[model samples]
Target: MAYRKFRGTKLFTGKSWAPEDSVLITLPGGQVEAIVPASEAGEDIQAIEGILSPGFINAHCHLELSHMKSQIPPHTGMVPFLLRVMTNRQAAIETIQESIYLADQQMQKEGIVAVADICNTLHSLETKKSSPLQYHSFVEVSGFIGNTAQNRFDQGRAAWEKFREFGPASIVPHAPYSVSPELFRLINEFDPGCLLSMHNQESKAENDFFLTGQSALRDLYTAIGVNIGFFQPPQTTSLQAVLPYMNPANKLILVHNVLTSMDDLVCLEKHPVADTYFCVCPGANQYINQSMPPRFLLDDQVEKIVIGTDSLASNYQLSITEELKLLADFYPEIPMSHLLQWATMNGAMALNMDKKLGSFEKGKTPGVIALNNWQVTRLL
Candidate 1:
């Protein structure tokens, strides 16, 4: 039987670093066969110039918005960025399809083995079906008005069901500001065990709106011709306002905690939801707001912190290595091995794909990737 053996500058098993003398052995198709000392490995061992680790798991991405790349200007703040996305999302069907295809191909080449992708429409369904990367579709629902709650829930549920037929999919709220109390309640009750991903505290405007009911978010609603007069300020942070409606049985993934504060973290600790993952897309945050999530988000307070590329609309590219490199540059204090764990294992666990992806454990077929001086390439 032919097996592939690899030794790199360093070997990260997705969880931790392998021994210096370890040589990774894998079946021809990339399944983990063993991690043996160099003395025991045969003469066919391959050498790598940089770190070898399992393929990355992108815990949060907006694949449906891939067509909106570069259409929205940078450093425009969240409200303006969102307004532009709403205004320009519509395009020729071929254009949308082509962008999704290209984005999918880009992820595969960058060593993203699986993704927890946001889907507002079926535009990406065919591409995901044929792509080598694994995808868990998150059908995002949003309705700020109480009256439209049921309709929005129904529409999102219908889309989720179609995606479920194709692969793993879930119905999730788009964001705290965009989801009404009624809509949140409906989504929580839909599936107790479902994985819930929400756009949480990406901007100060979100908490400002929830606390005072008067913010740029209201202006955004007005621009779209939606009446938000019936809405009232909850006199609390957005996360606190929405936590009660979240089912404890669900594994919640909070994406883009750019403005998540200490108070919010305390509130989260008191909440019943035990499994919470904080997914940070620094590239998108920097592009839209010229800011990054507080360094504390990577501290001990956040037990699980995963990385994502967001989408072409807010990010320059879909590479997790770029995201990691950006993170390394921003927070030079954090170790690369620690960041790799977040990019791979934490992300895979957040998406509930850890058993099959993330680490280089025997019997797991986590695709092999080589990070040569921050340049990413798939080796298997």
Candidate 2:
């Protein structure tokens, strides 16, 4: 393999940033070979600008919806915004294929090494098969009509099979408001150990729906003409209601915890909470929900905090650097080191890809990424 050495003013090898004179050596195939202090490098070294770090792990994304960028209006509350996505997500086959192709290229340019992408269909499977980036597909299963739960579960399984050929894949529920309790149980029974991801407490209406059965979601269900006959109000927060259906020790990823509360955290902490992760999509949250997640309050509950772009439908850019900048802008007290951890290593651990990606460990092929201001470029 061809050998290449990159010199950077600073290097963040997942744990901490190295000072000026850091050299990262890699094979042309991308596996890290060795690292050395800058003084030891030849004067003709290929120097990299800005912070040299491992490629960003977009813990969540929806590359399939790249065709819908700007199609939905911004700052609409979660319920209505979801409805808009449901109604507007349609295009010619070639249009979708082209958009997915472009989106994949954009992410590569932004230095996304791995993704935990949400999929409702296998439309983007072809793009994934040929792409160099790693993917862990989350086949999103959504159905509230109790009678159709089995059918929806089966369909999700079929989608999972198709998606698995490209990479690691699992059937995951979309959100508590959209997935019936029976469907959640069906998923838990299918594979308790598989990584399960759900949209958690993105809106007050989601909590209100489970706690009192009175939320805008009720009106949405009525307007959509779906009878939730098998559903029963849990009279608790949405997170608490679904806890019983999940295996406590199983890995779970909760996205957009804008409404997650201290009580909900306490309840989860009392159970097996070791493997749980909370992912924040700050841009998407601000764009679609008109709010920012109370991330500071959730610092103590989760083992790791990861970042995501959500989707093009809700975010303008797919860069984790932009997400970290927004987080730092909102909570200026948080250290850049911690934010870098969230964007890199924490995301890798969350997706269970840490063994191969995340940091510049000797023998690990963690892809190289360069960060400048709020943009990222994949150097390897």
Candidate 3:
């Protein structure tokens, strides 16, 4: 049951493209055997029209909130958004299940092969078990200030351990904003081998609260019965502040660094041991704050960046294509090929699944998607 041959006008071989080319893929399990000039295939070549590339990997998403598309009140700050989320928990959970079902279908149809999704609970366990796509679920935990830092770490570790029974891809985290410095220190001390994911400087208010200890967030914390009077003003950039508490050997996918300044990027560059990756959620940023992360921060660091749709609760749709399209529209000077890699290869790397899922390489089984009016003859 070998595929024998597939000739497309455009063939993306993960890292580069083959123009007017053909790939002789050995199937039974789809793996690229050889990518050669179209004329080299003789008469056995099967010409495939349109584009062909590796399946996409959405590096960061909250599938549990998939059901809340356009329903959560917009333009609210993060605190208000959280309150709204709490209020709508019951309805949101029901919608989350439905959204996950439809979103999974949409991912397949759009040629996505893997995801790095945030899980607040076990709600997504059954869905992941049933889906063909690869998943790395980060069990998210957050606490402002209460018990001992060791207690907080224990709570997070306990929750993660419970979910670990379901699969191989479970990880733990102290949610940003709410995670105490002491708890973060414990996380660093434990030094888990898995990658770290956190919402970093997603809002100006976050920066204000963390850096200066003054902002609208202070009011929100007070309202929520979490006093901020005893808290010390943050001494370092968010990335630096968290570095001591994270496994330096492990890569980090910093989500929504909308307000991350040049100093932060410099600090990241200084940490040679840190594999720092950025996950931009354009739609989610716009929904919550009427803005998106500054694309310029990614400049020469495009290779270190990936894309995510966030979730329907904070986005219009769960489509990586749309995310890339928005990126292209905003940063038209950037090459389309590079943008494609951000949505695919970079994403796979962020999820630590590049070895098996991201690219259309020798042994990878990433699905091929054809764009409308895409030229297959160009490949041949």
Candidate 4:
């Protein structure tokens, strides 16, 4: 392969940073030939930058809801916001498409390369077919608990088969809080050989219902005609509740872990067999609960945490860079490099694309992101 060099004042070479560096990245058949100091590369530099790093990867997003940017009210509780979302669902589709287009442009400008996007059906298929970014489309299914679980599972299976022809990465699931244990078991049987993504403990009400069989969610369930008596409150934590149905061989990417407690983290540590990951959507958390995930629970599990911009409907925008800035503000002690990995490499791993798209390692096709005039250094 012919080699190209990138000279930069600072280069983030996947795991670490090098000041005044040059990356000899081979092209055609993409691979890293060598990563040497800037003074070492002879003369074939293709680009020069003040700061360079691997392209960002968004772990969770609802691109179809991109059109709801600023349309949803700020700081609304999850239940009320979801009700509003359902009511305005039809009007949001066209705008969502437009949002996807604009979001693509914005992501590229801000240096994103791949995304784990959640889609309800065919809404994002067309947009994804044309976008330059890489995406893992999680076909979203939702229905009130009951016989509806099987029906939704069937619908999910049908959608998965239909869209399977569209791309290499596609999966299906019932949205959390909406999926029954039986349906979740059905999903676990698939063995997709990739990380499972789901909206885990995004709201306190969800945790409350699952833990104690009582919360605001009960009201919502009753209103929707879901038989409360037949529903046995989950005997375990939300993480444990979903564990039986998750593919044991594959990693699980838990999105919006807003209510995860210390005990939950301890359980995760004990069950080391489950390659669990956390994708924190701070903006979306702030929107729904006026709070963010408990960073303190992360502990020594920094490598297992990733970043995601949930959806424009519940976020300011689909920008991972902005998420990093927020992380910096909220948890300043967490190294910036680690934060970048959460937005980039860790996210890629969540979608099972790490081998080809996470870092600037040998054989990865992920692009490089240039950050100009940003002085934050040493991200590990």
Candidate 5:
């Protein structure tokens, strides 16, 4: 069997940096063969500059809204940005398809091997079917009104069923503020063991809407002709309010969390799920709210934190390396290894793809990539 041997730059095996003299050995097709000493690697060793690591895993993305890239202005608060997305997301089918295709291509070029992508429609189904990347589709359901819960779940179920026919898919709530208690119950019961992903605490308005009855999110509902007058303030943070409705057995990915506070983390510890991963989209958070998530709190409190690019709708590009660079720039105290683990191993674990895509374990086929000064080159 033909084999590939590489040495030179530091090797990040997705969990830690390998010894400087180690040679990464793999089959030509990118399957993990072994990591052995330079003397053991034998003849024809390939050399490269920069850190070589496992391909990136995007824990969260919105592929269906790729067409709205650059159409929504930046730094508008979350509610306004969401409202604009609602208005601008509608486009010709050809345009939407082309955008999804391009977005998938871009992520591939950026060395993303697997993605946990959000879907409200089947716009990305065909693209995903033919793409080389692995995907876990999150069919998002939203209905704040109690009476509309069933209808919303049914709509989301239709999409979920379609996506599951092709790959791993789940019916998940859109967010705490946009999903009613009844809807959450419906989603939990639909698939008791299914994984979940949710937009959480992306803005102060989201927390304010739950803490007090007044927030721009309420106004957003009203502007869209949805009366939320029947709702009452929970008098607590959004995550705490929604905790009671979630299934304790389900593993959950809480995305964004731009406004997630230390108080919220404490409350979460009191009532934890089976497994929880905190996914931060720094680019989207900066673009939408002009604010950063409390990374210090997340790093201190959370065990499994991951990174994402979100979508073109709310970000300049879909590159996990760029996201890591932004986080590294903002928090220089964070080691690059931690950020790489977040983008690789932790993200794969978030999407339940860790066994095959997170590390250099024998028999696993994690793709390889080289990063020099944050520029990515996909090797496999």
Candidate 6:
């Protein structure tokens, strides 16, 4: 906690990272004490090579499924993927514990200061309690069985309460296809002001199921012994159908969005929620649906776009930088500056941790991360 100056070869202040000149920030006790130009820097400054910036924020992730890394095959689409996950989600407790620990450590190493993790059970609470990274647990509420709405709500609430002692946690829906109208209403009654993050239109099949009632999901549900005959097609996009049920007061996060079309963006207007945001896990999109969210679908959406790695189950690793790198490799026009904001400030804002963990502003304890040729390195 002693005084030190972390002078970098180049520094990205969460806005710009250019001019290729020296930048210096003096810190004592993990707080930024001063920011001075290279000309004003004293000889005591500790110079280092690389791009220094605030740490990354994984806006959406599933740390509980850490043990399922590569457990299910990729590009199977949502129906097959969900079937595989449902069938194979359970593993030995020790294995699940070890994987979660390692994944948390990897996120810390990759400069992730905060994460918005999806939780379906309390299995990951111990890991979150001991991890260096800050976590906001989204206790996922998922049940399509209309008659079992109360039970599902109670289960989700119990999970949220279990995680609440560890950190900020709230009950949220799992996905559009998984939650019924009754269950969604129950979630609203539980707490309409809390933040909600859920899978949106990850694939066309989801839209197909809700829009036309003809989708693989129908068969999959029957195969799993879940009665869908009582469920009727909305004849509209999934998001549109769920919009009316959502409380405008709550902060909504729509994840994946691989199949979100230009038409789907129009449906967003019906969303009364003013604090809604979008999270794109580019790697997971490609892994599960064989296509990433198109650059056009994301061009105007930049203001709301935040990055997440989804889970190791559908991803090779949990590094937010790698997610950005994949996008950069594909879309060369998306300025690195924009990608950095999506990784840091935007994500922190989405998770409501902007005041402490986003930009390297005065008095903010935003952790320092060095991007050495686009590879994430924790400097603080």
Best by lDDT: 1
Q: Candidate 3: lDDT of 82?
A: 71
lDDT of 3 by residue, 1-380 (tens): 54657765576665667666666464546655666676666566666666677677888888877776677877887778877776665565666677788887777776677888887766777688788878787777666784666765676677677656755444445345677766666665665556778888888777777677676777777777777688776666555666555666766788888888888877776664368788888878878888777867768578888888887778877777777777777777877677678877888888878777667777776656554342112111
The C-alpha stretches of model 5 lying farther than 4 A from their native spots are: none
Report the candidate with higher lDDT, 2 versus 3. Answer: 2
Off by over 4 Å in 4: 1-3, 19-31, 44-49, 92-94, 170-176, 192-194, 269-273, 373-380
What are the lDDT figures for the candidates, one per model?
A: 0.90, 0.85, 0.71, 0.72, 0.89, 0.84
> What is model 2's C-alpha RMSD?
1.8
For residues 1-380, could you state the per-residue lDDT of candidate 1 as single tens digits? 89999998899998899999789999999889899999999898898889999999988888888988888889999999999988899999899999999999999999999999999999999898888889999999999888899999999988987899778999999998998889989998998888989999999899899898878999999999999887888899888888987888899999998888888888888886869999999999899999897898798643499999999999999999988998999999988888899989898899989888999999999999999988997998
Estimate candidate 5's alpha-carbon lDDT, on a 0 to 1 scale: 0.89
Report how far off residue 58 is in candidate 2 (Å): 0.5
Residue clash pairs of candidate 2? 21-38
Estimate, for each residue in 197-285, the C-alpha lDDT of model 2 and write its tens digit: 88999889999999888788887887788876556688999998878767765798899988888798888877664488999899999
Residues 229-254, model 4: lDDT tens digits: 77677756677665655566666778
Residue 114 displacement in candidate 5 (angstroms): 0.4
lDDT against true structure, model 2: 0.85
Alpha carbon deviation, residue 263, candidate 3 (Å)? 1.3
Clashes of each: 0, 1, 5, 1, 0, 0
- TM-score versus the correct structure, for each prediction: 0.98, 0.95, 0.89, 0.89, 0.98, 0.96
On TM-score, who's better, 2 or 4? 2
